[model samples]
Every structure is written in structure tokens, then in C-alpha cells.
Target: MQTIKNLVKDNMRQYGMFIALLLIMLLFQILTSGILLKPLNLTNLILQNSYILVLAIGMIIVIITGHIDLSVGSIAAFVGAVSAIMIVNMHLPPFLAVILSLIIGALIGAWQGFWIAYMRIPAFIVTLAGMLLFRGLTMVVLKGQSIAPFPTSFQKISSGFIPDIFGTESIHLTTIIIGIILSFLLTFLEVRKRNQQTKNGLEVINNGLFFAKLIAMVTVILIFSYVLASYEGIPNILILLLALIIFYTFIMKKTVIGRHIYAVGGNEKAATLSGVKSKRVTFWVFVNMGVLSALSGLIFAARLNAATPKAGNLFELDAIAASFIGGASAYGGIGTVPGAIIGGLVMGVMNNGMSLLGLGIDWQQAIKGLVLLLAVGFDIYNKNKSS
Candidate 1:
């Protein structure tokens, strides 16, 4: 019993927000009389918050490096406008337009990274200027209007679902099969990881606790798959998100560049003295942000089936809030990709739940603000307590 308590205490920071997320979902599920977890609403929740989740992925990395990009919202808008012109106005192929838009996003990131990293400018000032600059550019490109009726092919980026290969009408067999495969894969990976830890003389959690965690994870995945399969099967956006999460989580956990990022964030001067290229790391981080921001813009525009001048408004705030709530510390050098993704879901669920309850947008905003504040406060409290 004491060992179990010790384990929980040790992992509180890592698992706390995840537990909170589950609790929130459960509360909403009960309050909405089981409406919150319905297949259709669940699908809508994923589609609606896809862009914010994308932004949170990038934003968490930025925060990990002790920087913030205020201009992501404007950047997304600018990219969307550019893509709209290419696809809707000039009749360019959607694939080509997407590729070009991503390149443009990378260039924008490099521009900001150059100023903040090489030129020694503060990120806040640079991104603030960029926010205004790109917003104006978006307006100028759209001529203060909106572009509509994007090509069907482009629209599928957000609205499309993976087709059922089994051709079953009642349930999506492919989705369930995929979920089963994922469950086995996850179990294998966890067991192997535990074995490796033991082999390397690292501390391993109690066997019972570890197995319990594995069961919980597999159950969640299977249940999620069943829900989605019962509706329209898995969404293309969810696949993209899963891919991004897996790739980023690997990069942050296992790669040399990932370690460099954390080192630079933890202490730039110390990292520089130890042969880490702090400036280069910072520059590339922003460049990565730019690409993701652009991708987010594309997704948002595709979902709307139009590019509006006001598109992507306040996106930066949502992404930042998601990052912090997911456990990215304001002081830098502490965060995880999964944490950010979970944070985004928390916000998404809240928005969906409140909308179902007929709450006004004003109240939603206030509640979100309070949640963000509390999340940051919790981080600070943990830091002070550790000290």
C-alpha cells in the first residue's frame, strides 16, 4: 500500500492532467445525459478541434524552448488565403497548392526565426509584429473579402473519413481491426520498454501497477475505436493527428535534436558551452512552428470550405492555453507532446459540452480563462514545491 502511494506521488505531475481529462469527460457525459459521448458528437468534436490540436503540437515545442509565437493565428490566416487563391481562383491542383503553402509556411518560420535567433530580437516583439504584418497581408490578399467553395478534393482534408474496406454497413470492421492491432502493438511496446528498463538497471514500477496501466490504455483505445466505428469510422484528420503525435513524441523522447532542444530551453548558456548550438536549435524550432501553423491554417480552411479574412482569429491563445494546461511549464524545458494533445482535447471537450448545454460563448471564454489560469498556477506551485 505504501509502495502504491509512493508510485502515485512520484507520477502525479505526469498523470495528473490525464486523470483530470477523464474526470471532465465523465462529468460532461453524466451532465449531458450520455449525449457527450455519442458517436456523432464525438466525431464532431475531433473535426471541430483539429486545427487547435495541430497548433498546440507546435506551440508546446515553442514553449519548451522558452519562446512564444503570437503570430501563428495570423500566419495560418495568411497561408489559408494564399492556398485559397491557388486552388479556388487560379484552378491549381489541391495537392500542388498544399505543398506550396507548406513551403511558404516554412519560409515564414525561417524569417521569424532569423530575427529572434540570429538577430537577438525578443520573440514576443518579433511575433507581435508578425501578427499584425501577416494579418494585413491576409486581408490584402483576400481584398478584405472571403473565398468560398473550395474544391471537393481539398475539402476532404478535414471532412473525409477512411473508407471501410470490409464493406460492412452496420459497423466499420476496418476501424475495429486497426484498434485491435494498435492495442497489441501498444502492449508489446510497453512490455518491451519495461524489459529494457530492467535490463539497464533502471527502476521499474511494480508489476501489478504496470499491468494495470497497460489494461487501462488498451481498454481506452478499444472503446474509442468502437465508438468511432459505430459512427463514420476513423476520420482522416484523426489519422493525421495520430501520426503527428507519434512522430513528435518520438522526436522529443529519443532523438539527439530533441535533447538539444531541451538542453537549450533548460539553460541556453550552459548548453552553448557544452557544444549545443543554441541559436540553431531555436531557429529550427521556430521553423518547425511555422510549418505546423501553416498546416493548421490549411486544415482550418479546408474544414470551412472557404478562406475568410477573419479565419484563425484567437488561435494562438487556444494553442497556448492547451500547451500550458497539458503541462508545459512557463519557465521552459518541461513538457510532452502527449500532454499538449490531451490538453487540446480537454478544451475541445469543454467547448463541445458547453455548446450542447446551450451556454453562451461569453461564458465559455470566461471558463476557459479560469482553467488556463489554474493550470499555470498548478505548474508554478509544483515548481516552488520541488525547490
Candidate 2:
């Protein structure tokens, strides 16, 4: 009994979000009479949420540092507009424009980061000012007009799927093969990680419990692959996003920079006293946010094959809400990439499901708001109970 209780306590955080996701799907699936889980529709869910998921991953890091960036939406719009202008008017190469747009995004981050990190201005104020500044700039750059018919090469960023070397349309055999390998790789890594933890005398869960989680994870992945493989081939955007997740996850989980971020979030003064370059960390976080924002802008632009000053309106809200819903503390010092991904996906799936059901936008907005509230409220309740 004690072992079971302890295991439950240790596993609660991991299971809570999973349970919420399942409950959501069940409720929506039942209400919609099983329309939400159709394989093709579910695949659509992944494609739609791809951009927000990317933003949420970056937003999670920002919130974890006891800060927020309110200018992401405007920055994305502004950068996207710039990319569009370069291509449509200036006749710049699409790929070159993409690079230049990203550089501009980095510059925007440097501007805001300088204020927050070096001058010690509050992040909210800095980013808010940025929001207004960039909004106006985007409008001016776009001339209050939309740019359309972006290069097919650029449009493929969001609309394209991975092509099979085998040249078949049913499904990419390569994708299936890759999926199988990934599952096994993931399982192997988890086992090795748990064993390493044991060797290091760290508090590690029992082998059986860990293996159970491994099985659960791989099973879900396989099921998802089966669904997507049954329809279109793997999405390249999804693959790119997954690569970003893996790279960033490693940085956060294994690198000193990641440790410093958490340390600063936990207590900035303490972290500074411990010799962390808090300013640099904060600066880089913004830089990263800027880069990801640009990437999202491009994805959205590509998906639509158009760029408008209003393309990413209110997206900051989505990113911020995703972070908080995924267990980011408004007070900082808490969040994870996986949590952010899950949170973003929850919002994404909700929107997709509602759209599939032909629900009005207003009702969809309300439902999303309620879910956000519940998530944050549960987070607070959990924190209070633990404390």
C-alpha cells in the first residue's frame, strides 16, 4: 500500500495532464458522436496546431524565468510582413528573405532583452511597449494590405508532407520504419535513463513502473503513426517541430544553460549570487522566443500562402495561455517543454474538434477559456496543497 501510494504521488504530475487529455477526447468524442477521433480528422488536428505548439514551447521557457513576452504576436506579424515584402516587392529569394526575417526577429529580441535583462525593466512593460511598436510597424510595412501568392517553395513549409523515397501514395514506408525505430529508441533511452538514475543514487521509480510508462508512450506513438500513415504521409512541419523539441529538450534537460534558467526562475537573486549570468540567459531566452516567433510566422504565412499584418493577431494570448495551462507558474520557476507541448495540443485539439462539430466561434472561444481556467486553477490547487 505504501509503495502504491508513493508511486501515485510521484507519478501524479505525469498522469494528470494525460488524464485531462483523455477525458477531453472522451467528452468531445461522445458529444460529437465519435467524429472527433476519425483518423483523417485527427491528423488534421496535428497539422493545425503545429505553429501554436512551436510558440508554446518557447513561451514555456520565458514564463519559467519569471517573465513573459507580450510582443510575440505582433513580432511574428511584423517579421512575416517583412518576409512577404522582400519576396513580392523587392523580388528577393524566398529562402534569403526567410533568413533575413529571422535575423530581424533576433534583433527584436535583443532590443527587448536588453531592456529586461540589462536595464532591469519589467518584462511585461518592455514587451507591451514592443507589442504596440511592432503592430504599427507591421501595418506600415504591409501598407494595410495583404501579400499573396508566396513562392511555392515557401508555401511548402506548412502544406507539404514528407515524400516517400519508395514513391508510393498509400503511406510512406520510410515514415513507418522511422516510427518503429523511434519507439524502440525512445524505450531504450528511458530504460537507460532510469538505470543511470539508480546508479547515481538518485530517487528513481521502480523498474516495473518505469517500463509501464515506456510502454504507454510507445504505444501511443505507434497508434498515432498508424493513423497518420493510413492517410497522408508524415508532415515535414511536424518532423521539423519534433526535431526542435528534441534539440531543445536536450538543452533544457542536460545543459548548464538549462539549469541556470531554472535556477534563475526559482530565485533570481540566489541564482545571481551563485554566479549565473542571469542577463545572458534572459537575453537568449528572448532571442529564442524571437526566432521561434519568426518560424511560426513563416509557417502560418506558408500555410495560407499569404502574409497580412493581422495574420498572428492575438497569438500571444494563445502562447501565454498554453504556457500557463501546461503548468507554468505566473510567479515563474516552473514549466516543461513537454507540458507546453501538451497544453498547446489541448488547445489545438479543442479548436479543431469544435470546428469539426460546426460550433460557432464565440462558443469555441468560451469553451477554450473555460479549459484554460480549469487548467490553471488545478495547477494552483496542486501547488497550494503541496506547500
Which pairs in model 2 have colliding backbones? Answer: none
TM-score of each: 0.99, 0.95
Model 1: per-residue Cα lDDT at residue 287: 95
The stretch of ten residues in a row with the least summed lDDT in candidate 1 is: 4-13
Highest lDDT against the true fold, candidate: 1
1-387: candidate 1 lDDT, tens digit per residue: 988888888887789989999999999999999999999999999999999999999999999999999999999999999999999999999999999999999999999999999999999999999999999999999999999889999999999999999999999999999999999999999999999999999888898989999999999999999999999999999999999999999999999999999998899999999999999999999999999999999999999999999999999999999999999999999999999999999999999999998999999999999999999999999999989
Model 2 Cα lDDT, one tens digit per residue, 85-181: 8987888998899899889988998899999999999999999999999999999988999998898888878988887788777766767777899
Task: Note each model's CA RMSD in angstroms.
Answer: 0.7, 1.6
| Model 2, position 64: C-alpha lDDT score | 89
CA lDDT for candidate 2: 0.86
> CA lDDT of 125 in candidate 2?
99
